[model samples]
Target: MLLAALFLLSACKTEPANQGFCGIIPKRLEAAMSYGTSLYLGSMPDQEFLREDQGRSLRQIPPLEVREDPMAVQAVTRGRCAFSIFEESFASEQKELQGLKSAQLLYGYPDSVVFRMYVNPAALRGEEARTRTLDFLDTLWSDEFQSKLEFYGLKPVPEGLRTQVRNDLPGFLTTASESE
Candidate 1:
Protein backbone atom coordinates (compact mmCIF):
# COMPACT_ATOMS: atom_id res chain seq x y z
CA MET A 1 0.00 0.00 0.00
CA LEU A 2 2.78 2.46 0.88
CA LEU A 3 4.62 1.72 -2.38
CA ALA A 4 1.45 2.13 -4.43
CA ALA A 5 0.70 5.45 -2.79
CA LEU A 6 4.23 6.64 -3.45
CA PHE A 7 4.00 5.59 -7.06
CA LEU A 8 0.77 7.52 -7.55
CA LEU A 9 2.25 10.61 -5.98
CA SER A 10 5.30 10.41 -8.15
CA ALA A 11 3.17 10.08 -11.25
CA CYS A 12 1.72 13.51 -10.65
CA LYS A 13 3.50 16.43 -12.33
CA THR A 14 3.04 20.13 -12.89
CA GLU A 15 3.68 21.90 -16.23
CA PRO A 16 1.77 23.83 -18.85
CA ALA A 17 0.25 22.62 -22.13
CA ASN A 18 3.32 23.75 -24.12
CA GLN A 19 6.02 22.56 -21.82
CA GLY A 20 8.28 21.58 -24.68
CA PHE A 21 8.32 25.26 -25.56
CA CYS A 22 9.61 26.35 -22.19
CA GLY A 23 11.78 29.02 -23.76
CA ILE A 24 8.66 30.96 -24.66
CA ILE A 25 6.94 30.64 -21.29
CA PRO A 26 8.56 33.75 -19.85
CA LYS A 27 7.86 36.00 -22.83
CA ARG A 28 4.27 34.75 -23.13
CA LEU A 29 3.63 35.18 -19.44
CA GLU A 30 5.12 38.65 -19.54
CA ALA A 31 2.89 39.67 -22.41
CA ALA A 32 -0.28 38.49 -20.71
CA MET A 33 0.58 40.02 -17.39
CA SER A 34 1.81 43.21 -18.95
CA TYR A 35 -1.34 43.77 -20.99
CA GLY A 36 -3.86 42.48 -18.45
CA THR A 37 -2.58 44.48 -15.53
CA SER A 38 -2.63 47.69 -17.53
CA LEU A 39 -6.16 47.14 -18.83
CA TYR A 40 -7.56 45.87 -15.54
CA LEU A 41 -5.91 48.69 -13.67
CA GLY A 42 -7.16 51.26 -16.16
CA SER A 43 -10.81 51.12 -15.06
CA MET A 44 -12.56 54.21 -13.79
CA PRO A 45 -12.08 54.58 -10.07
CA ASP A 46 -15.42 56.18 -9.34
CA GLN A 47 -18.15 54.12 -7.70
CA GLU A 48 -21.12 56.51 -8.05
CA PHE A 49 -20.65 57.29 -11.75
CA LEU A 50 -19.75 53.69 -12.37
CA ARG A 51 -23.16 52.62 -11.09
CA GLU A 52 -24.67 53.82 -14.36
CA ASP A 53 -22.47 51.39 -16.27
CA GLN A 54 -23.34 48.53 -13.92
CA GLY A 55 -24.77 46.29 -16.58
CA ARG A 56 -21.91 47.23 -18.78
CA SER A 57 -18.91 46.57 -16.55
CA LEU A 58 -19.38 47.18 -12.86
CA ARG A 59 -16.22 45.33 -12.01
CA GLN A 60 -12.81 44.96 -13.53
CA ILE A 61 -11.34 41.68 -14.63
CA PRO A 62 -8.79 39.96 -12.45
CA PRO A 63 -5.23 39.58 -13.67
CA LEU A 64 -4.39 36.28 -15.34
CA GLU A 65 -1.91 33.80 -13.96
CA VAL A 66 0.12 31.37 -16.03
CA ARG A 67 -0.32 27.73 -15.13
CA GLU A 68 2.22 25.03 -15.86
CA ASP A 69 1.74 21.37 -15.11
CA PRO A 70 3.91 18.42 -16.05
CA MET A 71 1.49 15.60 -15.42
CA ALA A 72 -1.20 16.46 -17.91
CA VAL A 73 -2.15 19.02 -20.50
CA GLN A 74 -5.76 20.14 -20.66
CA ALA A 75 -7.55 21.97 -23.42
CA VAL A 76 -7.25 25.66 -22.61
CA THR A 77 -10.24 27.84 -23.31
CA ARG A 78 -8.23 31.05 -23.29
CA GLY A 79 -5.08 32.72 -24.72
CA ARG A 80 -3.36 36.07 -24.30
CA CYS A 81 -2.56 38.88 -26.81
CA ALA A 82 -0.95 42.29 -26.38
CA PHE A 83 -0.43 44.79 -29.18
CA SER A 84 0.01 48.52 -29.63
CA ILE A 85 -1.01 50.65 -32.60
CA PHE A 86 2.42 52.24 -32.36
CA GLU A 87 4.08 49.11 -33.69
CA GLU A 88 4.92 48.39 -37.30
CA SER A 89 3.12 45.52 -39.05
CA PHE A 90 4.03 42.92 -41.65
CA ALA A 91 2.29 40.19 -43.57
CA SER A 92 3.10 36.55 -42.81
CA GLU A 93 2.32 33.91 -45.37
CA GLN A 94 1.37 30.38 -44.27
CA LYS A 95 4.75 29.01 -45.25
CA GLU A 96 6.40 31.33 -42.73
CA LEU A 97 4.22 30.25 -39.83
CA GLN A 98 4.15 26.45 -39.86
CA GLY A 99 5.26 25.93 -36.25
CA LEU A 100 2.71 28.25 -34.79
CA LYS A 101 -0.17 26.36 -33.21
CA SER A 102 -2.19 29.48 -32.50
CA ALA A 103 -2.61 33.10 -33.52
CA GLN A 104 -0.34 35.62 -31.83
CA LEU A 105 1.74 38.76 -32.04
CA LEU A 106 5.35 38.10 -33.01
CA TYR A 107 7.84 40.93 -32.63
CA GLY A 108 10.90 40.29 -34.73
CA TYR A 109 12.35 43.72 -34.02
CA PRO A 110 11.42 47.03 -32.43
CA ASP A 111 9.36 47.92 -35.50
CA SER A 112 8.78 44.59 -37.20
CA VAL A 113 5.87 42.86 -35.58
CA VAL A 114 3.69 40.41 -37.38
CA PHE A 115 0.20 39.37 -36.32
CA ARG A 116 -0.01 35.82 -37.57
CA MET A 117 -2.12 32.75 -37.07
CA TYR A 118 0.44 30.00 -36.81
CA VAL A 119 -0.01 26.33 -37.64
CA ASN A 120 -0.22 24.07 -34.59
CA PRO A 121 1.16 21.04 -36.42
CA ALA A 122 -1.93 19.58 -34.77
CA ALA A 123 -4.60 22.35 -35.10
CA LEU A 124 -6.21 20.74 -38.16
CA ARG A 125 -5.51 19.10 -41.49
CA GLY A 126 -2.92 21.18 -43.38
CA GLU A 127 -5.34 22.49 -45.99
CA GLU A 128 -8.11 23.01 -43.48
CA ALA A 129 -5.83 24.96 -41.17
CA ARG A 130 -4.71 27.23 -43.99
CA THR A 131 -8.27 28.02 -44.97
CA ARG A 132 -9.36 28.58 -41.39
CA THR A 133 -6.46 30.91 -40.71
CA LEU A 134 -7.30 33.09 -43.68
CA ASP A 135 -10.97 33.14 -42.76
CA PHE A 136 -10.21 34.03 -39.17
CA LEU A 137 -7.96 36.88 -40.24
CA ASP A 138 -10.66 38.34 -42.49
CA THR A 139 -13.27 38.18 -39.79
CA LEU A 140 -10.96 39.66 -37.18
CA TRP A 141 -9.87 42.59 -39.32
CA SER A 142 -13.38 43.49 -40.41
CA ASP A 143 -14.59 46.95 -39.53
CA GLU A 144 -17.87 45.51 -38.25
CA PHE A 145 -16.04 43.46 -35.67
CA GLN A 146 -14.23 46.47 -34.21
CA SER A 147 -17.39 48.57 -34.22
CA LYS A 148 -19.34 45.86 -32.41
CA LEU A 149 -16.74 45.60 -29.70
CA GLU A 150 -16.60 49.37 -29.20
CA PHE A 151 -20.40 49.54 -29.12
CA TYR A 152 -20.52 47.20 -26.19
CA GLY A 153 -18.96 49.86 -23.91
CA LEU A 154 -15.79 47.85 -24.21
CA LYS A 155 -12.27 48.69 -25.28
CA PRO A 156 -11.13 47.69 -28.75
CA VAL A 157 -10.93 44.02 -29.66
CA PRO A 158 -7.70 43.05 -27.95
CA GLU A 159 -8.61 44.91 -24.78
CA GLY A 160 -12.20 43.69 -24.85
CA LEU A 161 -11.57 39.94 -24.66
CA ARG A 162 -9.86 38.98 -21.42
CA THR A 163 -8.86 35.40 -22.03
CA GLN A 164 -5.58 33.62 -22.58
CA VAL A 165 -7.01 32.28 -25.83
CA ARG A 166 -7.51 35.90 -26.77
CA ASN A 167 -3.82 35.97 -27.51
CA ASP A 168 -4.16 32.89 -29.67
CA LEU A 169 -6.89 34.52 -31.73
CA PRO A 170 -6.17 36.88 -34.61
CA GLY A 171 -6.38 40.55 -33.67
CA PHE A 172 -8.42 43.02 -35.69
CA LEU A 173 -6.15 45.99 -35.17
CA THR A 174 -2.87 44.35 -36.11
CA THR A 175 -3.35 44.14 -39.84
CA ALA A 176 -0.55 45.19 -42.14
CA SER A 177 -0.70 48.66 -43.63
CA GLU A 178 -1.76 48.99 -47.27
CA SER A 179 1.63 50.42 -48.09
CA GLU A 180 3.36 47.54 -46.38
Candidate 2:
Protein backbone atom coordinates (compact mmCIF):
# COMPACT_ATOMS: atom_id res chain seq x y z
CA MET A 1 0.00 0.00 0.00
CA LEU A 2 2.78 2.47 0.83
CA LEU A 3 4.65 1.74 -2.45
CA ALA A 4 1.43 2.11 -4.47
CA ALA A 5 0.66 5.50 -2.84
CA LEU A 6 4.18 6.75 -3.53
CA PHE A 7 3.95 5.68 -7.15
CA LEU A 8 0.68 7.55 -7.60
CA LEU A 9 2.11 10.71 -6.05
CA SER A 10 5.20 10.59 -8.26
CA ALA A 11 3.03 10.15 -11.34
CA CYS A 12 1.02 13.28 -10.45
CA LYS A 13 4.10 15.49 -10.22
CA THR A 14 4.85 17.71 -13.23
CA GLU A 15 8.27 17.39 -14.80
CA PRO A 16 10.15 19.49 -17.33
CA ALA A 17 10.64 17.95 -20.76
CA ASN A 18 14.00 19.68 -21.25
CA GLN A 19 16.23 22.43 -19.86
CA GLY A 20 16.14 26.24 -20.22
CA PHE A 21 13.62 28.84 -21.42
CA CYS A 22 12.22 26.96 -24.41
CA GLY A 23 11.59 23.95 -22.20
CA ILE A 24 9.83 26.01 -19.54
CA ILE A 25 6.18 25.04 -19.36
CA PRO A 26 3.83 26.24 -16.64
CA LYS A 27 4.99 23.53 -14.29
CA ARG A 28 8.65 24.40 -14.81
CA LEU A 29 8.15 28.13 -14.54
CA GLU A 30 6.42 27.79 -11.14
CA ALA A 31 3.66 30.13 -12.29
CA ALA A 32 0.12 29.62 -11.07
CA MET A 33 -2.06 28.11 -13.79
CA SER A 34 -5.15 29.71 -12.23
CA TYR A 35 -3.81 33.26 -12.55
CA GLY A 36 -4.82 33.81 -16.18
CA THR A 37 -5.93 32.19 -19.42
CA SER A 38 -3.88 30.05 -21.73
CA LEU A 39 -1.50 32.02 -23.91
CA TYR A 40 -3.45 32.82 -27.07
CA LEU A 41 -0.69 33.84 -29.46
CA GLY A 42 -2.59 33.39 -32.71
CA SER A 43 -0.17 34.15 -35.58
CA MET A 44 1.94 36.52 -33.46
CA PRO A 45 5.70 36.85 -34.03
CA ASP A 46 6.32 35.41 -30.54
CA GLN A 47 4.60 32.21 -31.63
CA GLU A 48 6.88 31.96 -34.65
CA PHE A 49 9.95 32.68 -32.55
CA LEU A 50 9.14 29.83 -30.18
CA ARG A 51 8.51 27.47 -33.08
CA GLU A 52 11.34 28.27 -35.46
CA ASP A 53 14.13 29.71 -33.33
CA GLN A 54 13.48 27.99 -30.02
CA GLY A 55 12.47 24.62 -31.47
CA ARG A 56 9.46 24.50 -29.18
CA SER A 57 5.77 24.48 -29.90
CA LEU A 58 3.35 26.22 -27.58
CA ARG A 59 1.25 23.10 -27.63
CA GLN A 60 4.02 21.08 -26.01
CA ILE A 61 5.10 23.74 -23.50
CA PRO A 62 2.22 26.09 -22.82
CA PRO A 63 2.57 28.92 -20.33
CA LEU A 64 0.76 28.48 -17.01
CA GLU A 65 -0.95 31.81 -17.45
CA VAL A 66 -1.07 34.55 -20.02
CA ARG A 67 -1.91 38.07 -18.98
CA GLU A 68 -2.59 41.23 -20.96
CA ASP A 69 0.51 43.06 -22.31
CA PRO A 70 0.81 45.48 -19.41
CA MET A 71 0.03 42.80 -16.86
CA ALA A 72 2.64 40.60 -18.47
CA VAL A 73 5.29 43.22 -17.69
CA GLN A 74 4.07 43.40 -14.12
CA ALA A 75 4.13 39.62 -13.81
CA VAL A 76 7.79 39.57 -14.75
CA THR A 77 8.58 42.40 -12.36
CA ARG A 78 6.76 40.69 -9.53
CA GLY A 79 8.39 37.31 -10.28
CA ARG A 80 5.13 35.68 -11.21
CA CYS A 81 6.43 34.69 -14.63
CA ALA A 82 9.84 33.48 -15.71
CA PHE A 83 9.75 35.81 -18.71
CA SER A 84 7.28 37.41 -21.08
CA ILE A 85 7.50 38.87 -24.54
CA PHE A 86 6.87 42.59 -25.03
CA GLU A 87 7.37 45.36 -27.55
CA GLU A 88 10.59 47.22 -26.61
CA SER A 89 8.90 50.60 -26.24
CA PHE A 90 5.88 49.24 -24.41
CA ALA A 91 8.08 47.19 -22.06
CA SER A 92 10.16 50.24 -21.20
CA GLU A 93 7.04 52.27 -20.52
CA GLN A 94 5.57 49.56 -18.33
CA LYS A 95 8.82 49.04 -16.46
CA GLU A 96 8.95 52.73 -15.63
CA LEU A 97 5.30 52.79 -14.58
CA GLN A 98 5.79 49.76 -12.32
CA GLY A 99 9.03 51.18 -10.85
CA LEU A 100 11.02 48.14 -11.91
CA LYS A 101 14.74 48.69 -11.66
CA SER A 102 15.42 47.26 -15.12
CA ALA A 103 14.06 44.99 -17.79
CA GLN A 104 16.59 42.83 -19.54
CA LEU A 105 16.36 42.62 -23.31
CA LEU A 106 15.63 39.14 -24.54
CA TYR A 107 16.06 37.91 -28.08
CA GLY A 108 14.44 40.14 -30.67
CA TYR A 109 12.67 38.52 -33.58
CA PRO A 110 13.71 39.55 -37.09
CA ASP A 111 10.16 40.59 -37.98
CA SER A 112 8.31 43.15 -35.89
CA VAL A 113 4.79 43.03 -34.54
CA VAL A 114 2.75 44.95 -37.09
CA PHE A 115 -0.58 46.73 -36.84
CA ARG A 116 -2.91 46.20 -39.76
CA MET A 117 -6.54 46.87 -40.52
CA TYR A 118 -8.57 44.29 -42.41
CA VAL A 119 -12.18 44.80 -43.49
CA ASN A 120 -14.19 41.75 -44.32
CA PRO A 121 -15.94 41.80 -47.70
CA ALA A 122 -19.04 40.29 -46.08
CA ALA A 123 -19.10 43.23 -43.67
CA LEU A 124 -19.06 45.64 -46.59
CA ARG A 125 -22.14 44.28 -48.32
CA GLY A 126 -23.38 47.65 -49.54
CA GLU A 127 -21.64 50.26 -51.70
CA GLU A 128 -21.69 52.73 -48.85
CA ALA A 129 -20.09 50.20 -46.54
CA ARG A 130 -17.40 49.43 -49.12
CA THR A 131 -16.70 53.14 -49.60
CA ARG A 132 -16.49 53.76 -45.87
CA THR A 133 -14.13 50.82 -45.35
CA LEU A 134 -11.90 52.01 -48.16
CA ASP A 135 -11.82 55.52 -46.72
CA PHE A 136 -10.91 54.11 -43.31
CA LEU A 137 -8.06 52.11 -44.79
CA ASP A 138 -6.87 55.14 -46.74
CA THR A 139 -6.94 57.26 -43.60
CA LEU A 140 -4.84 54.67 -41.80
CA TRP A 141 -2.11 55.13 -44.40
CA SER A 142 -2.40 58.93 -44.50
CA ASP A 143 0.51 61.07 -43.24
CA GLU A 144 -1.66 62.45 -40.41
CA PHE A 145 -2.25 59.01 -38.94
CA GLN A 146 1.32 57.92 -39.66
CA SER A 147 2.67 60.86 -37.69
CA LYS A 148 0.58 59.90 -34.64
CA LEU A 149 1.83 56.30 -34.60
CA GLU A 150 4.85 57.16 -32.45
CA PHE A 151 2.64 58.90 -29.91
CA TYR A 152 0.72 55.66 -29.60
CA GLY A 153 3.97 53.69 -29.09
CA LEU A 154 4.01 52.45 -32.66
CA LYS A 155 6.75 52.96 -35.22
CA PRO A 156 5.98 53.43 -38.88
CA VAL A 157 7.81 51.32 -41.43
CA PRO A 158 10.74 53.03 -43.15
CA GLU A 159 10.05 55.35 -46.10
CA GLY A 160 11.35 52.78 -48.64
CA LEU A 161 9.08 50.13 -47.14
CA ARG A 162 6.21 52.63 -47.06
CA THR A 163 6.74 53.36 -50.77
CA GLN A 164 6.69 49.66 -51.56
CA VAL A 165 3.55 49.24 -49.51
CA ARG A 166 1.95 52.20 -51.28
CA ASN A 167 2.77 50.65 -54.65
CA ASP A 168 0.97 47.48 -53.59
CA LEU A 169 -2.05 49.32 -52.17
CA PRO A 170 -3.86 49.99 -55.45
CA GLY A 171 -4.10 46.32 -56.44
CA PHE A 172 -5.10 45.33 -52.91
CA LEU A 173 -7.81 48.01 -52.78
CA THR A 174 -9.12 46.97 -56.19
CA THR A 175 -9.41 43.35 -55.07
CA ALA A 176 -11.14 44.36 -51.85
CA SER A 177 -13.61 46.52 -53.77
CA GLU A 178 -14.39 43.73 -56.24
CA SER A 179 -15.03 41.22 -53.48
CA GLU A 180 -18.67 40.40 -53.10
Q: Write candidate 2's Cα lDDT for 1-180 as tens digits.
A: 111101111211232111111111122112211111112222223445545633532122323332334543433343332224344455545533343222221112333553222212222223443343334333445454454445434455565655554454434433333644
Whole-model lDDT, candidate 2?
0.32
Q: lDDT tens string, model 1, 64-172? A: 2233332112211111111111111222221322223444432333233433332232222234333433343333433344334333223233433423444434432
The RMSD of every model to the true structure, in order and in angstroms, is: 15.8, 19.8
Clashing pairs in 2: none
Off by over 4 Å in 1: 1-121, 157-180
Error of 1 at 166 (Å): 16
Per-model TM-score, in order, reads 0.24, 0.32
